[model samples]
Target chain A: MNHFIIKNRKDVQKLSTLAIFAGKTMLSNGAETYRVEDTINRICSSKENIKEVDSFVTQSGFFLTLEYEGEIFTYLKRVKDVGINLNKINLVNDFSRQFVNQDISLEKGMKTLDEINNIPGYPKYLKILGGSYVSGFFSLMYGGSPQDFLPSFIASFISLIILDKLSKFNLTFFIDRFIGAFLSSLLAIFAVKLGIGVNLDKIIIGSIMYLVPGVSITNSIRDTMSGDSLSGLSKGIEAILSALAIAFGVGIVLNLKSKGWI
Target chain B: MSVLLQFMYSFFATIGFAIYFGAPVNSIIPSGISGGASWSLYYIMFSILNDKILATFMGAFLVGTLGEALAIKYKKPATVFITPGIVPLVPGAGMYYTMSYLVGRNFNKAINAGTEVFFMAAAIAMGIIVSTIFTRTIRRFKRQN
Candidate 1:
């Protein structure tokens, strides 16, 4: 006996939308493509409402098919503005778990998803302060002397501010990172030239950690190891590109300095 | 000791990064600890073995392991912790040096630095893969038991 629950088209739409909402949250918040696909599968595997879900996830969007009561429904969600917001990922993961356990109603679920999706990130002030700490301490660890600490910290703080301001204008991610990195290295070089720091290399490296693709590279490795080859490759490429952009930004500034153009 | 101090600094740096990464409030401290431990492990391993890549691999492995354990304990995904944990081993310095040399038209140094960065990235990937496989097998064993 085939015992899949009968769901109306309206119900299918709601549930699929909810699943897509969860998926968009995951993708936007830096969840690997495989994790996003698994979560979608779990959400759609409700014995009561749906029988199966086939989902295809990429770096930018997702396509999902929901099969229920001998009917098929498909959804395509375009994911824009990808950035790391782990809090959103955790929230979506929690909501998905609750949903899979049949602990939340459809309307309630929709409401919660919207709320989590719109949750405010940490304040800019705090972000700049954190950047300061990263630059100041990482420089010391990277072999910079105490004199370089203040320069690195100041440079990184300014870079974070520039990043925040530029991103607000809805600029592309590459440009945002490129310009953020350019300002960071420029500041570091200027500080070193003016006797603010002895080690330009260490200071520049320290400040650029804020722009490094550390998290992305780690996720790419995890995704690849877990057999999500496409996701791994896409994320790996993204990491490389971002790393290259940072390098380019720094290189430009250093070249100008070397050529007495700065 | 200075190693301990380095650990604390790395710890503090990661906490800041965790916040910026928007880690959940409760997991923030644990992620920071994970990041710091990974960095300090690399430092200690490098001091003993005098090899940057080996130290990075060991540190990355431990980071993956710790991240898995924390993910289980907190009922959250492992990426939450592991993403920020490997910051210290991501070869940011190597990438910068390579670019610097390349821009300055120093071909030999650029090649050396670029190759070093490439290898370091590979090692970090290897380390994460090893630990992820180990953890999956361990989890499966528990399930079988």
Candidate 2:
């Protein structure tokens, strides 16, 4: 592949914008901070005559600067709606690698990125089925009897549907997780009372497993290990708060049960 | 028998989570393998050592190493595998119990569970870090040779 040449200030600006756009896509889709920084630097530096590129990425946003022909350009983007979509991250990762290795034009690159951004996640029914599988199997793993499986599945299925509907309201992640957990626990208790579930604790744990901050904990540790302490700290706090939210949701139900209120 | 059952359960559970997290379809089985293997390892270690934190550390390390290997083989980022693989080992039960004890006004048990939860999380982090360092050192050694 021929080397992409940097011809003018416009080219440099376009390159920087492309790099930032790629980074934003990755970051919003749950790539680690250091990986985003690396992708931005790699893409920016891929072209000839680009003298330098530096990128600073965090969990929330990123800043990138590029130098070409004694001129410096900077792009700062504040990313919102940070959701876990590993497919998008994978696509963007492949896109960046192709951009660096092949002589892809700036316009084509932007178009490809836009396409990646527009790709929808798995179908909603499949995701709900996945949710039920997770909760059902988790309860079994937690030592729930065979009878507990159906109840756990039913509880998580309803709660996941509710959570999916709740997403449209644009509520904070905390409230979303809190309500998910609360609803699941309430359903679990009802299932046990109805003799559908044999173990309340196991069912509750399984249902709430969907709300646990698994991605945040993994990403925070990874970011920290790779020396991105700022992103790591923030993500760690996010993990803790989300866990607390889940706990609070469950605890309320348990307290009510003990008080004979539910 | 129980261990095998746990393995199968975790495998499917992890696959479910992998799908929910939008992992690529081609990568789902590998992530499930990593998750199931790590959880079984944790179960065995926990049974032998009777220590939750240490067992979790062992589990996380296995997941990290396996994830890195799978990432290299599949040419995808390690997080794709590691994220789903580590979820089963996360101390969700600990978090729940701690809050339950606190709500019950049992400060002593709450502190106990809370401290264990904190250390288990730290152990998971340390395990992943150590595995990463180990993999990096191996790569460096290969490069030097």
Cα error, candidate 2, residue A99 (Å): 1.2
lDDT of 1 by residue, A154-242 (tens): 99998898777777789766777789789999999889879889999999999988887776887788788777888889889988888
lDDT of 1 by residue, B50-93 (tens): 98889989999999999999999999999999987888778888
Where does candidate 1 clash, by residue pair? none
The number of the candidate with the highest TM-score is 2
Q: Per-prediction TM-score, please?
A: 0.95, 0.98
Model 1 chain B: worst 10 consecutive residues (lDDT sum)? B13-22
Give DockQ per model, in order: 0.75, 0.79
- Model 2: residues with Cα > 4 Å off, grouped in runs: none
Give the candidate number with the greatest DockQ: 2
Of candidate 2 chain B, the 10-residue stretch with the lowest lDDT total is B91-100
lDDT of 2 by residue, A8-110 (tens): 8888888888898899999999999999999999898888788778888888888888788788888889999888899899999999999988879998999
Give each model's whole-structure lDDT: 0.85, 0.91
